[model samples]
Target: MIYTEENIEAFNEQARLKFPENKKFFDRLKNKKIKKLDEAFHPVHEEVFDEVDCLKCGNCCKTTSPIFTDIDIDRIAKHLRIRPAQLVKEHLHLDSDHDYVLNVTPCTFLGSDNYCSIYDVRPKACREYPHTDRKNIAGILPLTLENTKVCPAVFEIVEQLKKAGLGNKGGIVE
Candidate 1:
């Protein structure tokens, strides 16, 4: 199903309910003898994104901040014709993790139409938001779990993984 703002609230609510089960599944996998969980996710990730378009729902940008690296700050500052320090002063703050994150949500560079004003120079983290299809998937399962509620594609990917019996015996469940 298409996930637009009108339906995303309900979708996220459902995701919230599933968090426990999802967490359990990942935790179990963490303790298991699984191999190539990340590789297993590749096709499912592609399939999910094929149907779920980010342009239709920029909830990630609206609800969460991406980690901006030093390079990201420099590039974005240059793009805006501002000094890096000034950009940091205006738009960023160090989070609890000591990473530079946007000071506000619904990101300042996000357009009304859900396009990024700094798409070309967006943060490395922004470019890799949701990070599902990346290699070494097992290492980032925790991060993936957090992203499920934020990105519809991530939510669907987890559901698909569960259905595939990810936590089942014999490597991956499926």
Candidate 2:
């Protein structure tokens, strides 16, 4: 898909509708401990991302907050020429998990054009949004399942994985 705002909104709505089924699929995959999960996911991740432009759909930055580690805070503060303490006081709040997150959605640093103002110094979590290309893909199935709602690329990746019979015991259950 083109991943325009309208198209992404529609895809997100469908992702919500399909969440239960996707959740079950993720659960099954998690239990199966599918070997070579990174091998399975990386190629699909590359393929889907080739077609999906995140700049066109900033739903993730628009809706979710990345956890800002101390290193992230320091780097972003340095980039902005501000004190880390000042940055925290002005823009961040501690979440239930005691991680520092943005005080507002759409992110304080996100531009109207869907580009990050602090892209160069953005948090580690922001850099790793969706988390599909990382090693130990099986360990993050739950996180990936949740990301399908926020990222069109992730939703498409999961759909492609399912069609490829990801968790099936006999290779590529066709």
Candidate 3:
């Protein structure tokens, strides 16, 4: 499916409907000690991303904030020619987790065209928004499950995995 707003909304609805089944599948995946979990996820992640362009859908940036690490703050501040403290004061707030996140939704740096104003110096979490391609795939199944709601690509990836029998009771097929 395309990543436009209407399509994203439809995808969100479909994801919501499928979440319970997906959760069960993810639970099974987590319980298994699959040594090749990353191998399974990495290829599917590449394939799904090949078909879905995030620039066409900024739902994650519009709906969620990435934790801004000190390094991210420093780099972005340097790029913007501002003090780190100044950047934080102008755009960030400490969350319950005590991590710095953007104060506003749609992100202070996200443009109308869904481009990040600080694309080169964006937060590390922004760089890895869906976190699907990272290693230790089993460890992050819960995060991936949650991402399915926010990212159409993630929803598609999970659906593809289901089709591949990755989380079946019979165990991963390949």
Candidate 4:
């Protein structure tokens, strides 16, 4: 992956949040690729990983809106002390693809520093922002791929994978 040491470590730390099924994809890769990924999966080198912080790179928060489930709407609305419909009317739009998404660019809920204004009640998608670590990799591989440019971590990880000979998995771009 192309991630700097810092973001790669952050992605490793958060990898557990991904769906377990996402792991199955590894089974089909060349062992060299798997070994490299395994190495990458190891706990981040403290200094290398810690040096890069999301505060410095809020690309993900600034560029994309997480898909909001109904439960997410209810939770975020209750947290904001507004009706879900009202929240939707004021801030969200039902995406034509059948998902709920924020209506504005940079996200209306994103703070200036790219912190989520609704951190505690951010949507499930936000909570699981990079689906790369997902268990359902088969289903979400496309989503993860789509999110690459918007997430430096995913970008780095895929770049690393390509270097490890997993380019067949679509980890590298032309």
Candidate 5:
């Protein structure tokens, strides 16, 4: 079944409700993705993708932190019309990677309509949400896996591959 942004959102919510029971499955997929990032490339990206509506599934925007560079900070702060320190105080924190990132869940910066509060000057990572995209596709599998849990399209694509006997076979699709 093709996953539209709407259904994907519904499923993500369902997954959360069932999170306790499905934790292992999600872990398995996450681990499998790490171990076989290379194999995941074709299977994940072969699916027809959809434009992201942050309002529908703000999981990525809200739950996880994205790596933020100095330029990202400056741009976002400029958009917000406050000092960089103020923006950092309001929306971000220093991660283990030593990068500034969103500090809260459901993203403090995500609007009720799913629009990023700092869209034009948002962090680089927000601009490149599903890294498993067309340009430089071959170089993004690892990054994509890291985001697969929060992205239903990637999750469903990989799920379909395993069910269709494609994961282990690693066969070419003419």
Candidate 6:
């Protein structure tokens, strides 16, 4: 589905309804063989994104903060023609985890149309938001589990994984 404002709410509701089953499948991973699935995950991620357009949803931008590395701070500051410290002072705060994060939601850089104001020099974490295509895919299942609520693409990817027989009653080893 090409998610939009009108239908995304319903779609998110469905994703939420299915969250527990998805969580259970991930919970079993502690003992299940995970390494082999990394090879399976990338192509699945690519395939889901071929149909899911993030610009239409942008729920990640609306809902969460990306960790801002020092490099992200400096690069975005330069792009905005401000000092890094000033940018940090104006827009960011150190979270409980001691990571720099945007002070506001619906991010300051997020345009009304869901484009990023500083797209060319956005934070590295922003660039890697949702992290579906990262290496060691199984190690990040916890992160992916959290993201399924916020990203339709991630939700779709996990559903695809299940359909591809990651952990059916027959089990993954088969």
Q: TM-score of each candidate?
A: 0.95, 0.95, 0.94, 0.67, 0.66, 0.93
Per-residue C-alpha lDDT of model 4 across residues 1-174, encoded as one tens digit per residue: 334334645654445444242344343443324334334422222223344466666767666777889999999999999999999999888898988898877788877765778999988888876655555344445566555546666655554554544535444321
lDDT of 2 by residue, 1-174 (tens): 657766777887799999998998888787877778899889999999888878888989988999999999999999999999999999999999999999999889999899999998899999987899999987888889999899888888889998888886665521
Ten-residue segment with the worst summed lDDT in candidate 5? 165-174
How good is model 1 by TM-score? 0.95
In candidate 1, how many Å is residue 66 off? 0.5
Better of 5 and 6 by lDDT: 6
Question: Who wins the lDDT comparison?
Answer: 2
Pairwise TM-score winner, candidates 3 and 6: 3
Model 1 alpha-carbon miss at residue 115, Å: 0.6
Runs of candidate 1 exceeding 4 Å displacement: 170-174
Over 4 Å off in model 3, which ranges?
171-174
For candidate 3, the TM-score is: 0.94
Candidate 1 least-lDDT 10 residues? 165-174
Question: Candidate 6 has which clashing residue pairs, if any?
Answer: none
Worst 10 residues of 4 by lDDT: 40-49
Per-residue lDDT of 1-174 in model 6, one digit per residue for the tens? 767766889878988899999899787664575557666777888888888778888888988999999998999999999999999999999999999999999899999899999999999988887788898777778888989898888888888888777765575533
For candidate 2, what is the total of clashing residue pairs?
0
Please state every model's RMSD to the true fold in angstroms.
1.4, 1.6, 1.4, 8.9, 5.2, 1.6
